[model samples]
Target: MYDFYKTISKTKIDIVYLGETVCSKRKLLRRDDWLEIAEQLKQSGKEVVLSSMALIEANSELAAVKTLCSNTDFSIEANDMSAVQLLKNKPFITGPSVNIYNPSSLKMLAKLGLKRWVLPIELSKEALSDMQSEKPKGVETEVLVYGRLPLAYSARCFTARSHNLPKDNCQLRCLDDPDGLLLSTQEEQKFLVLNGIQTQSAKTSNLIMDLHELINLNVDVLRISPPSKHTEKIIELFHKTLHKAYSASEANRALQKLMPAGGYCNGYWHGTNGIDWQETTEEILCQLS
Candidate 1:
């Protein structure tokens, strides 16, 4: 894990989100370990944010959230309401899991100390423009430009269940599939990915082709959810594209080769089926308008 952070630290990624946002049972790194990593990343001139789990089911989990929220050194990305409540009056970020769907919700959270909010994965680009227009004075907007969309989270451990093991006694099988265990449809079509309690899109959400639209929308940040492999290259691709060193088309083609077996999807951003991919063209942009 240290080596992974050390490697990415040299990349053009500006902000590094640390800590486990999924199942609490995956405890290879403790709170101290995360803080140490955060320190190292900060020392490397990268802004670090500690992320909390999406679903805080137990008292132990709630306690863990409290510990993260109390950290004076780093800001917390509140993934759950419990983390949000604990982080009230403190400058913090709301993760993608927290539903800030409208201007009203954004306003409410901002009043409670929302420094920034990640647009929900399912929201269309049109919706983002609307939110941005009414976005508060000091708050920032962040979009997940890349990664497999984290669709949902349940108390149940799907990874463990797949292995025919109960949640409590289940071995930490999620480690075996670091990216995620891909699930397929009846006809053997790639469907969704099972990562413990979280369900993610089988196809990666790639917005390399839509960087122009995002820039036009006045987005504050472009987030790339780190996959297990080729993360440094992915960061470099986005960096070069963002800096105009590489055109979006060239970067998009390069990204295709780096992605896993499942193809790419950007339909959710188009306000359509999440699994479908639509090429960004002047005609398509006009229709969206």
Candidate 2:
């Protein structure tokens, strides 16, 4: 984990999200541990944002959210309303899990001292264009352009359910699958992944293909969600693609080699089936628009 942070810190990526965003039960890193990691990343000249959980069921979880919100050192990515309540009137970024869909929600959040926000994964390009036009002054936007899309969050632990064990006594089994446990269909096709309470797409969502549109839209940040492997190279490829140092087609080919098994999906960005991979081109973009 330390090595991963060190490698990412050296990359040209502007912001790095650390800490758990899905499950509060994850204990591989305690508060002090995350603080130490944040210190290391800051030392490497990387801006770090501690992420809050998507759900706050237990009082202990709410207390943890408050602690992250009250931190004086680094900024935070608030994922729940509880975090937002604690962070009101203070500069902070909202996470993708915050259910911000329309311009009204964006305007409301902006009024609450929101400096930036991650576009919800399911929002289409056209939808984003509308939101961008109506976006509040001084508010920036980040899009989830890579890695498996986080589909949903639930209170039940699907990983523990797989073993016929209850969520409370799951024995921290999710740690075994550092990335996530792959879920397959009856036909043996990989469909989704179960990471504790978070369900993610089985295929990595690659939007290096949409670099042109994102840049055209003036997106403030292009977030490359971390996968199980090849993250450093993936970051490099995306960086090159964004700068036109490499073409989208070339980057896509290279990405295929780097992530051979994890396939790619860009449907949500195209307003199609979330799992579908729609090849976008000048002609196609014209037709869609």
The prediction achieving the highest lDDT against the true structure is 1
In order, candidate lDDTs are 0.91, 0.88
Quote the positional error of residue 172 for candidate 2 in Å: 0.9
TM-score of 2: 0.95
TM-score of each: 0.97, 0.95
lDDT of 2 by residue, 46-154 (tens): 8899999998999999988988899979999999888999999999899998988999999998999999899899889998999999999999999999888999988
Clashing residue pairs in candidate 1 (N, C-alpha, C atoms within 3 angstroms): none
Give me the overall lDDT of model 2: 0.88
- Please give, for residues 234-266, the per-residue lDDT of candidate 1 as tens digits: 999999989989877789889989977578999
What alpha-carbon RMSD in Å does predicted model 1 have with respect to the real structure? 2.0
